[model samples]
Target: MKRCILEGTRIWQGDPEAKDTYVDFKGSFRTEGTGRVFLRISADSNYTVWVNGQVAGFSGCADYPDFRRFDRIELTKFCREENELRITVWHYGIQTQTYLSADGFLLFDIYEGTNLLLKSDRHILSRINPFYRNGYCKSISPQLGCSFFYDATKSETPYQESVEQGPGLAHWREQKPLRLKAPVKAKITPSDKGYFIDLGKETVGFFFLEADSPEEQLLTVFYSERLIGGKVNGRPGWLDFSLEYKAKKGENRYLNTFRRIAGRYLFIECPKGLNIRYAGVCPTDYPLVETHRKFADPLVQKIYDTSVYTLRCCLHEHYEDCPGREQALYAMDSRNQMLCGYFAFRGSAYQRSNLVLISKGLRPDGLLSICFPAGMDYPIPFFSLVYVMQVYEYLSYTKDQSLLPIVRGTLDTIMKTFRSRIEENGLIASFEYPFWNFYEWTDLSHNASQIGRTKEDKTPKQYDLSLNCMYIYVADMYDKMTGEHTETEGMKKAIKEHFFLADKGIYRIDTLHDRYSQLSNSLALLAGLGDRELAKNILTDPDMIPVSLSMTTFLYDGLLKTDSGYRDFILENIKTKYKKMLDAGTTTFWENEDSILDSKAVESLCHGWSALPAYYFHILEA
Candidate 1:
């Protein structure tokens, strides 16, 4: 058996007057057998995992009282017995006041055939690959250590940098640029009452308590890299100070300026024997272990545990970025519990209203993060469906008939705004604004063309399969709920005759174009428009299968609806393509397979749609 343990490790030491206080430990591991692995990790705050050198999973939170995040990795193909794992961990904020006894260990069970051979300590032991601290730490899940670049420069370019307040800092400026000197000296002074740090920024990073208490400790940076300083105004993280600098910029001028201003930028600890420990240096590649621990029962438990998270995620209650009740619910949980309200607002009021109700049950500004794709600006046929679906979901999930007044009022606002924009053809026209106005059609990369507004307009009149089908589904669902079918039947008939090219065995945006999209196929079947048998057959077809299997939502749904053969096909495909997806190293599913886009480029990483698999698992079992 292999194992590594660290006990009574203090990551934070609170003193009334201290500059620094916090500690963190991290490690990495790889598996050596094609079996299952169970990981049990407990820490002060939370941890994240990267498989095959990409972020694969993460867990933990003080917000949700019952949130105990443990990971069980299935080392199949993408992750070989010799795979790589990376873990980064953040310690609890000093204000947490939880008894500190930090521990990190790994136990791996090696197997040969049905019999188990050995289980190594989470850390790898080898002659050439010595059991040093650095490399193994790189391969572990939930790593510790974040990057800090103030005046870090290479090749004469100053990185573009900004210092802004975190969750709080109403008084602080947004993306405030700060000039600094090289080797910035960060020193702290600790007193019995609290602590203080003179970092030489316009804002002094310090804390003071009125009397003796752990929460009174000053200079409490939960993670030093993220906070120059912050306040605890009622909520846990009220005030915030952070430095965000781009390393890719020319000359790194901003970093150089900050470095030049500060004399010494190295990690500093204050007097009174500060509770601080060097989490680890920045930009340093840590060591890693390849083998993993396995357990038959643990794997089952993991599935059940993940299902609970999926439910929480579907309600947009857990993850990185949950949406509001009034927004569209994407199929996944992008937000952690903080915004555990809703998903994407591509187009669906049922999804949005469910998400918004979930949010209202939690926070006041729950719906702010709910983004309506091409709302107000880019008008598209599918976008309005988002509004309709959210209303239905909100009504159903909450079962609150009293809110009918609010719901009706919001619907009126939507109808009044969009009704005027509908073209003579009864289809909502694409926004005719600058810079690719329509969200769905315009943003797609497959040689996108415009959808004209007027009947006489010249742009391709190709109607979208997914959009039209969703229109039918939402319109029908809405009419049943509200006693007004309106023009729903007309919409459904038009879609069936025009886009439903029967002879081709696949629906098309335009029968003449013969375009076949994975989205069109999935939505067509899901909306109950296409022939079930033909749709099932085409889904199993090798060429279409790859695209359909790219996202787990489709696969999970297909597997539940189809027989053993179809399920096996998707299972094998997922197993085969798992590594390629993780090797791409994305925290969330991407718009495409290639995920190495510029970080500065605006893209959705925690998009709700991609997380549908998490939700699909529950629906499958149900």
Candidate 2:
């Protein structure tokens, strides 16, 4: 049955054109002899729920308002004969790459067992927060959402105090229960800057601080996936994630709970004369049971455990590319994450939800965006092909056919769009539309291209061997899964004729570039465009452009397909590369091998896509 919003609550919006807005709401109710008190809470964009000054819960999973999610909390423990409830809703009025922002609103209901108690209405005392200066600052990673500025000098509002109110007037329907798990306490270490708390692993959550100051002071908290030279590198850049709070005199207790910040390390900087009592992170993640699969080798065991932990950090309301930076769901990233989930976790619901979410990103032009449920559209053409392959993989692993019907239309549209672009030679022509043609993060000079600065770079507009091979691979899977014919043979033949250098036993990056890349040739082997001998030579060639950690998953897959004996070699390679991370004291896999990148500040230490080795362990053994 479709859930409806509580009756009489009007959808609230401070300013329709405001990009960011915060609305504080307060309501009070009296309950006598309550067996159990429950609160069904939800809001547009996101919300944090507090009952009588104690943290109750939070809700914000990207979704359309019609299908908005609500969390059910047992408020019995916090409830009293006379009770007060407070909620702060951070409504991003504008959309972004990961969230579909809409009008600001909050819908909630309080029930005593089965008996009705309270529902959100206009009578609920609500006001636009004067403290939060929306649009005052921008986020380091735009996709991660906006930053906030709150002025402590401003007069404090009684937003948390109980108030007599009437009823709200908006209609709503209930959906799935919120998937955000309860927060866990993190481990902390003292540092010169302040104190560093390691959540033991990367996770998406907020910092919890309890301190007291003789005088007013400002506290700054910096977050990062990895430290640089034994210190938190919070410099302003693409990955800069931090927060600020004002500590009042006497007692200061607060939780940076509005945004779900992701990091393994937190550096708290307290002003002089402030007495620090306690500081730690309340780590948040999806409540998925870890698979108890074990390996005899301790190194392999650590790798496997780390991979599982990486996935856990990336799993929340959806599969994020990285918790520290974007926190957006990319088809390519989520595809790898889903494969790892199939082996490392117990259920398929999260994978299915992610697949369906990406499928919803299909545009009118038959192309999917780089991320789903986004406000703005940034299409990575090849990632659309990856979406098809991801569906095939999900079906193969889970044997769940129900998703077919759900994604069938989007799949058909993608095939039709690609088919329309195929030239007479049966290969896709250079993309004419504005789209990202990213394959991997390999050196552009090595691939004979001048465009590699940004992921959205568009240069060397010509037929690409890697993209065509990816298409062939997905087409084959589509044919096998749907019993629908795809022109995989024609694509394979075109790829061979145009890109493969028979005499050199290497495939060109594209028709225009004479350069060879591991990405193109390795994919050729995986798509069966080249033989095992060719794959062997490509794997051994030092002259070939090296693959990035993100693309190494494909390289390994291709190598294993060419020859099963490569398993030992593959395991050794995994150990060699991942050992560097382990030696560096990382509890999770990294976005890239540290040596390949000059700086550790930019690298995500707990990247989900890098967790492919966990999946490989299961497959190689089988």
Candidate 3:
């Protein structure tokens, strides 16, 4: 296949030194007959396109420039003999977990059938947005990416008019159009703060508002995935995702296109006399049809439905971990998401794209980042091993051998990377650096000392049982996927020899720690190091380190894999856990039970990794 490169467009930048900048580009084209118009668009970080002040399209491909994806939007509805198009591109200059920040650039081409209409070049008028100043640092999580501060008082409405001068231009090749779906709106309620809207579910998209005020007022919009104390809490760590809009008197309508806000509830606070005509969310997600899978149990059905909804919310431009806090893609999260998607949504394209995107994120040291298309690099060694498992899963579901060639080098590199890290005891040792040795967020008392440790802690664990077990699992997966075999027998033998506590009939956390976790034991069972009896015992153990929300999927998976008869028990357990979330008024699965721990807050109520019950339901039914 020949790669198509952008010929006429040059990379554009508003300010060379600006960290987080917004650039606006405007161009007009006269159609000869106006039968139909198509636009090919791509931006560095993100972009939204408007035609005659109406949203024509919006997308930001999660990839590097060389392999950048572009959206081919059909503007037939918004087209006329004489038409104007405006594009707003956000260039987040700082490095983050999700976005790979680079120089600001916008590449686009317009066409009326075969004849070219207008292309993004020096001729087009472009300028920096004067109104949108970097306001408060409202980052839900440092990994998600930066938030936007729109000062509507500074200037005119964006996307409503074209600017005179702007940034330079950039060139990019065209890919497939982004999967688009109609935005879903939610119900609104009146409150002292202002209008409170409940999406009835979590989603990732822009906030829509229509209102009228007697006098000029500042409208503050607060977004949250979970409500605390029966109200939306904005202060979660350093994340206060409150966007202020300066509204003129009389009537006004607005949609936040600059930043995609993720939440299930919106608190729109305004001054007195500000009549909110309508307040709702324009929910966005990957284009996937609703699942037809059904269950007799209402609790199980609700869990399955909410799990599917959670997966949908996380399936935006990429498979994000959570739409509210960190709209970043983690290999481990996506692996689970892909598995659930196979049974629920049954889509393969997005799964393939996610796998390829992560494969492209392999660093110089043969390790993939915790997330891809990201600016700053934070590699989780265990996640890299999971990447191998994810690829195998993708192949198992889609049976698409095409991606194998693309990720062949990446697979080999990862295997070699892990192989080099193996200790003398045949187990993969924890790294010396502070590289996020996170397995699961177990209770503090269970594994208190092992929970949070810095690289400076010279105390050497004999071996990481969970990490080595995952390696063994992936090695076998890799061997099965490809023809080549990896010598994982020694690693499996070492896990039993070094980490297994025979007297307790369970696996320890490691040789150094006198503690054990469901995570390590479950991985041991899933990786074939432990038997069904051990798995059953671990599943029923009350004294063991409880499985966190994220690791619950693995625990259940190990249980089901160990003994098919435990299916009913697993299903009932899922109902017991998720019923608590439902009772707590969650429309989707949570990041963890931390939200319920205190009436004050929760991390994320709509996490993708927690959507594993959906997979289990489908797998069990089959």
Candidate 4:
């Protein structure tokens, strides 16, 4: 019911380490309606909210980056008549003071129509207190000035993490070793002929030039409105931009398989001729980021990350392009490069090889494999092979020696982790658990087959053919690095015996009975897991084309290794699939060959795994 809602609170920063603390503020509001209520809250990071007796909402222990405002939540679900909103704040800290305000932490206004129905210090409550806060209280405000009571030094402090927000970027959560880059010196100056603005590439977010000078610079960024597009001299600004399409001076540019990556922004004053020319270039090969405000907004990234997690949770999809499909795919190489570096430094080799895209946390425990049916829940060593391959490929392309220490450390870590997982039968288990389809299969359109489950079968799940082959490839790479044949020969022999079928081109899975899957067939070639000749035949197989298309050009890669002629054919196919996806209005990669438009239907959006095509496209071009 398109009900208008503007909700948030303003509060003073309090020394969280004080007890019996109170903050009082006065805000006057008058409203009339049959069912009118204001959801008010002082703060709710791991706390609860109450407006009179009705419950508002409960929050988990969160690492909120700021102390200026309260959560702006929709309270339409909790609106009540005769609004006497009272908030009870609880603190688990032994030496912290919680702040309470009458205008709330911010002013929240609610209306049923033009009639201002309910106005309160806060808007929206958890309706129920979170059980996390050990203690509770009643009646905290309206004193306006002195609103706290607690031993400022001995009060328990609310727990917090350092992932806070910024102006044109997300919160700077020191990514282990690398904190967010320092703000580039952006200076705009006026020249004699025209205004020369030197942002010095502080172009982290959306920037538009309104006119030649600050007098005509109509720049105002509002958080509540997601509308980021603006006008330059009363004309469509960003939409009117046309680029020369190349990296600017003094910028590092990266070319991924499908996109280019560069860090520069240019805002040109429109010329007053027949057509005003505004030019800028985004080096990535994927879609240009639509909103710099969003990219720079930590809240947006948090929300986007939530969407990515939701998709990962629903289906075990781990490809970067699934959620922010194009965006993730474009950033895959850079992101993984960083991830590989981070894990390498952390001494977690188990994750070094897993070409994990976006998952839960940046730790070994959260890495997932690229192979489908592997899903986001499972992490296998094969994906590590892919990751290492890409890392080497990027090193070769960029010739950046800065990554050497990381690469070497990662190889060492992967070897150690894989050694522990390898069974006596020369096979490494996919995850901590044996293969028992962790979750039901979700299809391309985000629909479930709804297959009923049976008892967990433990018949020593036949050695997965694709996985074993990838092990051979990675083990071989490891041998190259260490100058010793460490487990490569054994893995290779097992792959050939168990995975290679005389009749079918490749073994889909390790079953005594031969069954071929497009995935198993393609990965066999991609991973260099099977004989070169057979891998080529499988790629051109008529039955495999749909599956191959579904797999995108990720498999086109193996064809380059096997048969050079497949290059043109593969590129053409990539174009065709790109067009098809565009036709389907698909912004990201699909789980199957359908349903790419339903945004709510979850699939891994930041899947660094599936974004291989973007990287592959770059590698092939190179």
Candidate 5:
């Protein structure tokens, strides 16, 4: 099938590489009694289409330039004879964990059938948006990108002809469109400087507000995943989850789909006599049709329900590590999310799209980047191996052999990358520089000092237990998938000789470092290096260094492989840990057991990878 012609010239004003800028395009199109019209659009960072000032759609899928995607939205009902079309595109030129630096441009086309009636050209007027203070770009986090200062009192610059680049190139994208869902009606109580509004539970997405003020006032909006002293903990250390909006005299209306926020509470600071019409977040939620799952035990059912909600909050443009902190997709974080998603959502489309997106993350050394569509180089090597397992699981669950071809080269390159790294010692060496050899948030990897170590930190020699075992595990999966041996048996033997501590009956992190972690031992068992009796012994020992919530699946996997009877043990273990969170009145599980994420204020109360019980429910229960 012939794809849509790259007809519309990519157009923008100002330095195409301006760090953080907002540009608006204004044009009018005559419908002329159209049979069926569609708004075909793509942008550098993000865009929102307003047909006569009504939000038609928002967001461009987080992507890279070589592997770009375009959205085709049907506008037959919204379009009229004299229609006004306005699109605002937020261009983020700086490199973040979630975005790659690219020239700011947009390709917009209104087409009826194949013939394009209107296209973005020099005629479509555009200019740097004045309402948003462009140079005052404050970051929410490295992953989520920019937060803006929107001024309703500011004047606008007259739109000019947009400078033309060449034609655009992209394939039509397929995903559920984001919809504005009403949150629970908030209860607003007056505070020292602002009013605290709670949506009653954890929520994800953008903020929208309509209010009437007695006079012109400047209001500061603060939001976060948790509260401090019964108020929103907006600013955590240096990170800012706060934005300022200047309101005019009478009624000020604002709904920014561009600046996204994820939290249950909003702190709006306003003057006296400011009447709030309806001020709360309208979640720009990705559609989740939940499977009606039931559990005989009430606590187990509650755990399953919250786990599903956690998964939903983290799933937006792509699978995020945490919607509050980093709305970026890491391979390992998403592997757990996908495992749970296969059960909760009961469909493979979103997971498949995300897997394909992950496949597009190409690096110079044939290793995938840390996050999808991110331009940074610091990657956790274990996550790349986990990605191999994710693709295999997708095929296993769906019995779909077709995706192998699309990701065949990627899978092959990842294997070759790891295979070449196997040293003369006959074991995979831990990466030293420019890479994070993180397996989990464990002391063995020494991640407790820094969640991800800096370039200066040196990892152990060639006997990293989790690193080698991960390679062996994924290599076996690849070999099984292709029926070609990766000779993992030899590597497994080398791992056993080097890392196994006979006295302790557990595997050490490396030969050089005398450290043992639940994850390293779990990986050893799963990779087929240890005996079943040893697995039973190591996993049951309370003295063993425990893994974090994200690594629970490995422990669970290793235990199940030991014997299916461990299912009861697994359930009880899950209940014991998760029950504490439930008892603490957590609606969504914490990023860590301590509710400590990066800093105290930035605690992600609703994290995605912590939602793995959703997967366990489907697997163990079924």
Candidate 6:
């Protein structure tokens, strides 16, 4: 009988400050007979698995230090009695939007027919990966962490020992392994500086390349969702979508499991001598199959399929706002995704898991982080209130009352924070310094988008219409969930007392400004501060400030709440709006309608929030 341990041993690179650290581990164990083999593994950041010399599986769920999740990988097909295992783990030691910095470690467990054969410890051979440069930490975006520089010319180092670090603060739990798909490749086309590889559509994936070079060929890969001036504009906006790799002489095979590129085009800048055999990206999707339902109208059905595809692209470990640039989870952005996901997909686990992940992002000030597990402290007050609504809707749809108790404290904290901020006018004032008071991309919330990253707040404090309306909405949800009394009536009264313009049949932006926006008006109607007549008026007002693609969900919801027959209006509106994207041959929807003609061309083409037609087409059949 073989003595075995079920849990894997945790190993670290021995230094926490070794940011952008990548380690390669390999070990071998002999089995007496052929049996089912499995590997249970977890890591601080990300991990990839290989059996013998063939690729097997890759991905560690995005987790907080308090709750580190592991993946269970089956390797029966790739293994033999005399077997070798290789696992490469890249730990981002610094905090970013989706990833939180934590103890950098890797734990491995191998099992054969329930008999544990191997586990990670100092006994397992490991060394710092020589191919991937360790310290050259260049960022693709502040939101999406770091870019990689791989040098194939660099020789592998001698196997060394990995220091044993005990299981960390996070409780260990097994998770469903990531779904790996076949790599999507493109024929290389000659361009200005190099060759452009277009995959025909946006794909959230890992870079894979198999090529041969006459001599040492240094290649710079510039990738993007769309082309500017017929060239791949890698750094379209605040993003630096580029990677550098040194190809050694002869054949070179690389499957970059580190940085996940979300784009249709990859432009490789290399000399003429390099011969490309295969070049593309392998998509890693959240393992959830879609239930297809085509509409009567072919255009509507086409839009529905495209919207569903957009939602699929954004869902990896969690619900990312977009797969292109900012692969982070924000409450406001995810609220749209969740509502649409309720109709598009069958399972509720992905939505529930995302709600839990966002719950772990609470700050000391009682607001959720701008994004989940984000290192920075730029909390959006409007977005935080949306969390309560999201939680209610999630629970309401699933009837999963169990989740409320888990997230009840978060709900309480968020409500209290906003309630306490109510000023003499009976409305919550705009959040002070450090807290971004952004409502939407439009000038509705004073166009806070102009203020990029700053610690100072130049905007004055006034009772903002959107914030107060959201507070009322959240307070109502809080009251219903907790069965506790809230000052929601007073808050609603104050909102009407200050911002409502009865004659104009709309709400003002704030006390400081006379502006009115579709977002603010929609929120007011949804919160029951207004009635069906108000909804009809808001829909008709040509002068009301229009909403962006992100906030259109609320607009549609408000309209439906007052009148179900308004579904026809929503169906036509959606078909009209999303048809433009269909006409442009978009595989996924755009970030906003303005992105279609905008010269900047830096907008994300596959935004999850913009995929609301998937939800509408399901409920309000066109």
lDDT per model vs. reference: 0.33, 0.75, 0.75, 0.34, 0.81, 0.81
lDDT of 4 at 221: 15
lDDT, residue 390, model 1: 52
Query: Candidate 4's residue-wise lDDT over 1-622, tens digit each?
Result: 0122333322222443333233222222343444444332323223334444444433211122232222333345554444444343433232111112121122334455445544432323222122112222211111101111121112233422111111211111111110112233444433332323333221212222112221212111111000113211211221112111112122212111111111222333322211112222211111111111122434333333332322221111112232221122212233333332232122322122222222211225323332211112223344455554555544444455455554565566656666676777667544424212221122221112212222352334445555555556556656654465665566656566666776756664554446555555555665566557666667555644235333443356556667787767765665555455445433333443343333332232223333223433434451
Per-residue lDDT, model 4, residue 51, is 42
- Please give the distance, in angstroms, between residue 407's alpha carbon in candidate 2 and its true position after superposition: 1.8
Best TM-score among the predictions, by candidate number: 5
lDDT of 3 by residue, 1-622 (tens): 1344543464454464366677778888888874678887767767889899888887764886456666678887888889988888877777778777666677778888888888877777777777667424446567766666665546553333232223323323233344443456667788776877787766677777777878777777888876767787767666777777777778877787667787777888876656766666665556676667878877778889888888887877788888776788899899899998888875588788788778888888888876888676656787888899899988988888998988999999999988998778777877544455667666421233542565567765557778888888788889887888788888888888887787788988877876788888888888898787788669666778888877787788788777888888877777888889999778888887665564546467778898888888887772
Give per-residue lDDT, candidate 1, residue 519: 58
Q: Give me candidate 3's TM-score against the actual structure.
A: 0.91
Worst 10 contiguous positions by lDDT, candidate 3: 161-170
lDDT of 1 by residue, 1-622 (tens): 1123311112221221221112222333455564555433333334444457544433332121221222233334335555554444433322211111232222223233334433333132211101112111111011111112222222332212111111110111011111111222445555453333444321111111112122211122221211223421111122112222222222212211100011001222212233432211111010111112222444323433332332232221122221111113221222211121222122233333333332221112111112221111212334345556655655665565554554554444444444454445544433332212232311231223442234344554344555555555566556656776446455556656666656667665433455565555655565665555655645554544234222344334434454444555544343344335444433233333332242322222223343333332223321
Question: lDDT score, residue 61, model 2?
Answer: 51
Off by more than 4 A, model 6: 1-6, 31-36, 168-175, 449-458
Model 4 error, position 281 (Å): 22
For residues 1-622, what per-residue lDDT tens digits would candidate 2 score against the true structure?
2355453344453563466778888888778764798887667777887888876777665766445555667788888788888888888776677777666677788888777787776567777777777655456566777766554545765533223222342322222333444455666666655677767666667666777778777777888776677777775355557777776777876675677787777787875545666666666767787887989999888888888888888867688888777788999899899888898888887788778768878888899977877776657788899999999999999999998998999999998899888888888965644566677767641232422245566556589888888888888888888899986788888888898887788898888878898888888998897778887877787788888887888888898788888889888888888888898877778887873244546667778889888888888872
Ranking by TM-score: 5, 6, 3, 2, 4, 1
CA lDDT, candidate 2, residue 619: 84
Worst 10 residues of 6 by lDDT: 167-176
TM-score of each: 0.41, 0.89, 0.91, 0.42, 0.95, 0.95
* Model 4 whole-model lDDT (C-alpha atoms): 0.34
